[model samples]
Target: MKVLVTGAAGSIGRVVTPGLAERGHTVVGLDRVPQPDGEDGAWYTVDCTDPDAVAAVFDEESLDAVVHLAGHPDEASLPDSLSSHVVTTAALLDAVHEHGVTRFVYASSNHAVGRTPRTDLLTVATRPRPDTFYGVGKVAAEALLSLYADRYGLDAVACRIGSFLERPETLRQLATWLSHGDCVRMVEAALTAPAPGFTVLYGISANTRAWWDLEPGRALGFEPQDDAEAYADSVAPDAPEDVEVDCVGGPFTSTAYERPALDRSS
Candidate 1:
């Protein structure tokens, strides 16, 4: 199948593009940044926020699927994040409808439910209680994906991606980390799921202590391999002695909106 991957130069896209190629799918990578030319697949300089540019690409390629990963991807960056999330999503969904694209795999965020208290019952059906403006935008995109799927018969799947980090070092990430291998599998499932309405799936690995649930995603045939629990011994044994909140999802929930920036590497 011919696949169009937006944000092809970004972190997940860099890994995911080659992964798709290895799976025997012809890939067309689109991004704002200039990447080295690829003979294995094509690359484009289209801006996903522009409806005309996005629509033109769709019209030119008889695309079988679209992995929509083009957007601002920062947690602390406020208005910019909101703008990037909302505009890019709107433009891409509109283009998908215009071009008769069959499947759309959108990159939503765990932050969409960031404000929800960490518990065993963190299902996909959980109502979005966003902790930041970025989270708000992700929730908004999820709604748009659902509406597009219902109205246009597009196969839209929203993956509420958790921390796609290498491994956990802090106490919070031990339960929220989504491994790279697991991310690839989840995206594959989103693209190839047989039955689709507006499915929302958590993008965490097979971690036993994860607060997010994966039963809703089981129907998509995604079975994660890596579990963050493997890093328990190497990571911090307890939450920071001075810190306040202490469930899996991290200080993100109880963090004062104006608190000093915690080092992302921590």
Candidate 2:
């Protein structure tokens, strides 16, 4: 597969690119910053929010799939995150559809449906309850992907990712960790699925502390390999009693909206 990966320098992209290349996919790594040295891909420095920037890449590379990970990763700045998450997603979807690209792997987040009770299973069928502006943008992207897929014959997958650190480090992560290995497998499944019209899957490891159901991811052939329980003893053992655990997004729901939300690292 000739894959165009957005945000290739981000933490998750750093984990995903090598594995995709190892699987023999020709990766076109796109990001605001340059893709790191030793990464096995053609790197392009481009802002994902710019349609021309995204379209220019499509014009140059005949792509088979797009793994979109470009976004400001927090609920801090509404305008900046919205620009990257919502506007960039729209641009990418249209560009791919226009260029006849077949598959799209959208990196959605658990925060999109963050207000859902953690006790209830969060299936793709569940209603979206965005906890913050950032989550709303992801939800918007999911809807945009769906519209394009249904109307324009693009195959798309929106993965509602959980905590995506090197490893689970906090009490909340025990139930929501998305290990790097599992992240790669999830994207591969999205790209290589035999028949993917439009799907939504949670992106997380096969952990015993998992709150969201994995049935949707299973149907997409995403076999997660890691379990957060392995690091349970090493991570923070207790959550602040005042911290709400009922919603899927945890503190994101309560975070005061602030400017500069879309920092470079996010």
Candidate 3:
């Protein structure tokens, strides 16, 4: 299958591109800027908010799947993040659906449901309680997944991904961290699963401290191999003292969530 991965040079994009290549997919990596050391897949410099740029790629590539990872990972000065996350996603979805792409794997976020209490188990059934504008963008993008699938017959999956760092960087991450390998496996499942209508999968590993439900992802064929428990003892970093530690979104739920984040690579 020929696959196009937007944000292919960003933190998560760098890893996902090569993984798809290893799986025998013809991968095309697109980014806002050329990566100094991009992967072996074909690379294209693209700005997701620019419909002309996105359309240029679609006109040239006969894509089978799209792993839409292009977006600002956190809240920004309103219009920029809005145009980048929401508008960019809309453009990509239009192109994918119009071109008859078979599979679309949207990189949604845990922040979409950040305010849900921790005592209640998090599942696909949980309603989105977006804690920030960034979270709102993710929720809006997810709505596109459902629309595209229902109206255009696309097999799409929106993954409300958790902390996708290289490792469990903080104590809060012990429960939210998604291992790099496990993330690749999840995308593999999305790309290969048979007739996956439209669904939501919480992107998390098999962690002992996991608060999100894994059954939905498992049913879609995502078998996570890594666990955050391995690093719990050394999980020295933590979220801000004022931030609530009980929710699924961690720091993102705080009003002080002004930090600029990278993509949800997991």
Candidate 4:
């Protein structure tokens, strides 16, 4: 299968490109920046927000599937930055429909369900209760995936991805950490799963204390091997004590809507 990965230069995409290539799939990496070392698969310079550019790439390459990973991942502080995210994702979905590409996997975030209280997280199904514009953009993308699946016959999966880091360093990471290997496996399952349509699954590993339920994803044959417990000792001491920080996915959802200002003293 030939897969087109948007935001190929991104942290997850950088690792994901190689992982897919190693699995015998051809990868076409699209990013705004050129690949510095070019060690990965074919890299194409692109801004996913541009409809013409995104469509041209799809028209040029007969993409078997699309792993949409490009977007503003953080929404807490940068409310003004999500216009690009919305435009890019909206364009990507449009291109997918135009090209008749059936398989689509969107990089939805745990932040998409950000407004849900921490206690209700375990049972509450995923809805568009976004806490920030970035999260709102993700929710929009998920809605597009659902609409496309239902109306246009496009098969899609939305992964409410937890942290793709190796370990949880901050308070929110305890509930959000998604190990590297686990992500690869989850993505692989999403790609190969049969009859997936508008499915939304959390991107957490098989941690002992997982906040979101993985039963629905289990039907997709997704069984995470890596566990966040490996980093328990290293990150446990840094855990937040109260609600302001504890287990609600941190400042990414809790922070005020203000861009990070430069420290003049620096």
Q: Give the worst 10-residue stretch by lDDT in candidate 4.
A: 257-266
Instruction: Spell out the clash pairs found in candidate 2.
Output: 77-261
Q: Comparing candidate 1 with candidate 2, which one achieves the higher lDDT? A: 2
lDDT per residue (tens digit) for residues 1-266 in model 2: 99998988998888788889888898889999976877655888999888998899999988888999988887646676678798998999889988998899999999999878778667778899988888888998899888988899889999999999888877778889999889999999989998788899999899898888898989989999899999998975564333446678888866454345455664
Best of the two (2, 4) by lDDT: 2
Query: Can you list the residue pairs that collide in candidate 1?
Result: none
Q: Which ten residues in a row have the lowest lDDT in candidate 2?
A: 254-263
* Candidate 4 clash figure, as a count: 0
Q: What lDDT would each prediction earn against the true structure?
A: 0.80, 0.86, 0.84, 0.76
Ranking by lDDT: 2, 3, 1, 4
Candidate 3 residue lDDT tens string, 169-250: 6777888889889989998898888899998998989988888899989998999999999988776554435354667677
Worst 10 residues of 1 by lDDT: 240-249
lDDT of 4 by residue, 42-93 (tens): 7789988789999999988998899988876664333344555567777888
Error of 3 at 247 (Å): 2.0
Candidate 1 vs candidate 4: the TM-score winner is 1
Q: Flag regions of model 2 displaced more than 4 Å.
A: 239-241, 255-266
Candidate 3 residue pairs that clash: none
lDDT of 4: 0.76
